[model samples]
Target: MRTLSGDLIAHRLSQAPAGALSKRLYDVLQTAIQQGAIATGSRLPASRDLAQELCVSRNTVLAAYEQLQSEGYLQTRTGSGTYVCEQLPETAPQASLSPSTSSAPFNHIRLSRRGTRVLARSGAGAYQWGAFMPGVPDVSHMPHDIWRKIQLRLSRRMPVEALSYSNHGGCLQLQQALAEYLRVSRSLNCAPEQILITAGTHQALDLVAKMLCDPGEGAWIEEPGYWGFRNVLAVNGVELLPTPVDDEGMLLPDLASFSQLQRPPVLICVTPSHQYPLGSVMSLQRRQQLLALAKSAGSWVIEDDYDGEFRFGESPVPALQGLSADAPVIYLGTFSKTLYPGLRLSYMVMPKPLAARMKMAHSELYRGGNGLAQLTLAEFIREGHYAAHVRRMRQLYSRRRAALVKVISDSLGPAFLSQQGNAGLHLILSLPERIDDVALAAELEQKGVLTRPLSAYYIQGTQRRGLLLGYACVEEQNMAETFAPVLHCLQRRLSPA
Candidate 1:
């Protein structure tokens, strides 16, 4: 039996802080065993000897040993000293199981082409909430108290059916509430049966991509549009055709031009309410034209109305789906901006003909949960709290947007120009043609400012140089202070050294 020297244990224990002697001793010994400094099956010094060497009471050493034994780090033998466990608990450090020289063969694993593309364009930053972090709403102001009360009420009053797996679309209450709300607010014509609840817009897009288009079919996405839309379509093996966006919105290719191609787009996605990054509302004329084109081409339109609720203009524009009676448009909306992102509740108003299949596919692809939350949100909208909250946030976001615009004009001067459109929570600051927006964005991030480079949104052709700055989560009072770092970074970069 090999015995561990009291001197070696004392040396290891000496490095630990002066805490409860037993706990400190236990931690030190545990780490030693985990690191393989103490070999398995080696007998440890007797409690009295270790206690004397470490200058701790024998009772403390005994307590430490007892803890180690209970935790499976040490094994006690009848009429024998405590020994390091031969078979440590499953929670034992993996490093202790093998020689340090061995390496994992991670390079041998192969990812699909689709997976590789998805990873290549993952521009999501580590930090999502801060000054000028685009697309995030002011979740700090969400009505948590009211939401919690509703959640509790639903939990208690809900029937047993609410707790089980929901094989259908979603909670009927939410669908009905959403149907009524959409009719009045967004002019969306939909029955309760047509609404399908999803985790968020990404899942909605994924389902639509799967159902409407086959693999290798062409899908038209707005150039300089939402990256989430691009990635989701790419991962599903759909060929993405980047259609350019002008002041009016997506500039659709002529039908003759599409006919020339071997595979024309069967799916067309647009943020007609407020075009992402460069907030341009699709003109009424263009909306009709696009609808007519889609109807003729046998194409399905996906209208992402994300953040349309908080439009800061005269009046919110009606959704594209409401423009015609049987328009082939899937209207997508989410509570992430109005309420909170963590809620992860979004819905799509599907056409009656395609509704059943999409719902079944959604259920089969991703099973639904969070029934209580859906029920609570249904009550929230039914009781008019959702509308009330939207009104309040609209005023708050408008004020913050104005403050940020003024700060940018004052700080950046003619060097940067704010782009068009007064709707949506973010503003685009167009940079000088020569300046690299990506590098500037990186510098700004290091100084505690978050902004998305406009160039990153473009997939083809000449990319615009600008920054998308979100002001919804930023307060009017702190706007100047929050923008100071960005101004400093810009000044430092543009200054003649």
Candidate 2:
């Protein structure tokens, strides 16, 4: 408990005019307790005496003190003066529970104990690499003013019911909008009935895994794939059968290399449009073959189209879902890369039977996706803002990709083989036999150039020596300046012997 005159409280309250005097006083005292400025058992002044000292009415002091007492910030026993509460220190937003492993099965946030190093931008760090961060969209490019206005306008005008927990599937309007968008862009043949809104592609992947995989069962995850898939699958106890990927993409024969589980493989996780880490796009012939293999093996293909929208060179490739007319293919895509990461909106195109299955699954955990954000995004796509954004981003990403390629080629000088798919934000720089790719990535990080080693994405072995460098987040005008440091890294990695 702490003693303070009403005059002292008045001086403290004047700092935050937006907040009430009582609230400000309570906050000041609360922070003092948190910082250990006021130790336990300190006594506060009597209301009447504090009022008299400050020349304020007794009622004002009483009301402020009384509010604090009721809220458990202060304690007042019969005939006892006010004292600070002995409970936990106060905070605006109470800290979330420490990731408890024993409380519940699903209460944990699963992350890999191996090779799961995210770059500075995604982690807790100060200096930024300008704006070039992987898996991040330029939020500054988003129509924020228009979106805020829409949110405000909608909140004021819409019926209260419209703002409540929406339809389990998603908003009808959004589903309709997505159905239309998918048809045009990805060549996905489905109506609003087949689409389900998820927190993002990560959620979509988790849900599919939950519905599809039994513990200790097998799932084919592409080698040199996204680390997110590994984290999600490991958390669910799905035994990952790491299928190796060459230039052609996921090798069917190499997947047969791993020991089979009790259950047959349930899913084949892939990034067909652009393989993660390696940045190799799966060929159309291979896509058909992979679907046929999945069909024969009685497994589903989980298409992780994380960056389906940003493709350059030729026309955008049709998704594997489009190829799988009869086969069971769960198509996953996200607006996180297309929009901003904070939006946390992704969708899935499921087969009818699986859609019914997920309905039951989401019923248990996921109540529903964000309604207002979904609704506004639906409008954005329907009115063609999304398409325009993708087109603009494609051009920008292409330039950055080219810049990365040129710099790496010049710096490495014949060690690099420029791969084909000039579509996405990232590209792979092939390494020679002598240098370990992982060590090279660490070396680059020391020089203040962040790049992901392709080996981190691999499970068992047979990963090519390479590094995945993202340029989509980099500014076109600043590519030369940004690539300068990276060029030095390439020189160091490419040095003789």
Residue 1 of model 1 has an lDDT of 24
lDDT of each: 0.86, 0.71
Clashes of 1: 0
Residue 371, model 1, lDDT: 87
Which 10-residue window in model 1 sums to the lowest lDDT? 93-102
Candidate no. 2 TM-score: 0.74
Question: Candidate 1, residues 40-103: lDDT per residue as tens digits?
Answer: 9988998888887778899999998998899898888889988999988877544222222245
Q: How do the residues 307-389 of candidate 2 rate in per-residue lDDT, one tens digit apiece?
A: 87888888888888987567689889888777787888888888877776686676566877577788788777887887888
- Each model's total of backbone clashes: 0, 2
- C-alpha RMSD by candidate, in order: 9.1, 10.0
Looking at candidate 1, what is the lDDT of residue 415?
A: 45
All candidates: TM-score: 0.82, 0.74
